[model samples]
Target: MTLSFDGTVIVPAADPDDGERTAEALVPHLTPTSSVIIVNVIEKAGGAPDKASMEQREKHAEDIFERTRRPLQSTDAALETDILYGTDIVERIFAEAQDRTADAVVFAPREGNRLAELLTGDVARRLVKEASVPVVALPQRDV
Candidate 1:
């Protein structure tokens, strides 16, 4: 089957490299007219949080977006960035996807220890199970 994405694509930007890697991997599938929305969610901790830490998190997220956008410069794909704060990461992503009227959701499979997966819950697995739009996970690879 020939696969392609044209409308807004919701990309999970969990790390600096995740977005870059995902864009590169999708180069073959995406057309020059495609637009990608790179999103990073900072899971909020319960209870009141300090202002300084929150500011720091936002700054760091901007840095990640800058780094991620660098590699995608070679592609004709239009890029957009979003930094979100929420308790449920997956839900936040889904909400953004729906609000943006995304044609698909793309993510780079994050490798974690079994214990980590059990503790935090696997995002990739959960997305596959519940995503309303098509979910595309690029094959795992070393950075």
Candidate 2:
């Protein structure tokens, strides 16, 4: 089945590198009518002190958006950036998708080992398995 990127897509990116790579992978799939919402979720500590200050985290999110926008600039797709806050990253992403009425949640899975994924609760796996909307893991190009 051919996947169409005609409507709004929610893209959750963890970092600058992931954002850039995901954008690159998604570029080929998007059409002139596609709307891309590239998001960075600032994980809260759930009442505890955050790992980084809000200002710093916001700056980092901006960096992610900047890099992500590079490859996407070549496409005619509408691009937007967002910063979200939540204790659970996957939940925040899903909430955004629902709020935006996104057609799909698209991303390029970040590289990690089994142990790391297990320790971190494997967000990529959860995103795919527990999605209310379609989740597309675009294949990453070799560096």
Candidate 3:
């Protein structure tokens, strides 16, 4: 089945590199009228002491957006960026998708080992299993 990227899509990036890669992978699938909302989730420490200052995290998120924006500049897609905060990454992403009435949540799976995925709660798996809308996993192109 073919997937269309003609409506709002929620893209959650882990970091600058991931943002760029995911954006690159998604570019080929986008239409001129697509609305791409790229987001970076700052996984808050709940009530515990934070890992980094909020300012630092926000700056990092901006960096991610900058890198992500480069690839999509070639397309006519309306690009936007947001910084999301939550303890659960997947939940935050789905929340954004719901809030935006997104047509799809698209991403390129990050590479990791089984042990790492298990330790980190395997967000990629959860994204697919718990999606509220169409979830698209774009194949990562070889660098």
Between the candidate structures 1 and 3, which one is better when assessed by lDDT?
Answer: 3
Span of ten consecutive residues with least summed lDDT in model 3 = 1-10
The lowest-lDDT stretch of 10 consecutive residues in candidate 2 is: 134-143
- How would you order the candidates by lDDT, starting with the best? 2, 3, 1
Q: Estimate every model's Cα lDDT from 0 to 1.
A: 0.80, 0.93, 0.93
Query: Per-residue alpha-carbon lDDT of model 3 for 55-96, expressed as tens digits?
Result: 999999999999999999999999999999999999999999
Q: State the lDDT at 78 in candidate 3.
A: 96
Answer with 1 or 2, whichever has the higher lDDT. 2
Model 1 RMSD in angstroms: 2.4
Error of 1 at 31 (Å): 1.0
Between prediction 1 and prediction 3, the one with superior TM-score is 3
The reply for model 2, stretches above 4 Å from the true place, is: none
Name the runs in model 3 displaced over 4 angstroms: none
Worst 10 residues of 1 by lDDT: 45-54
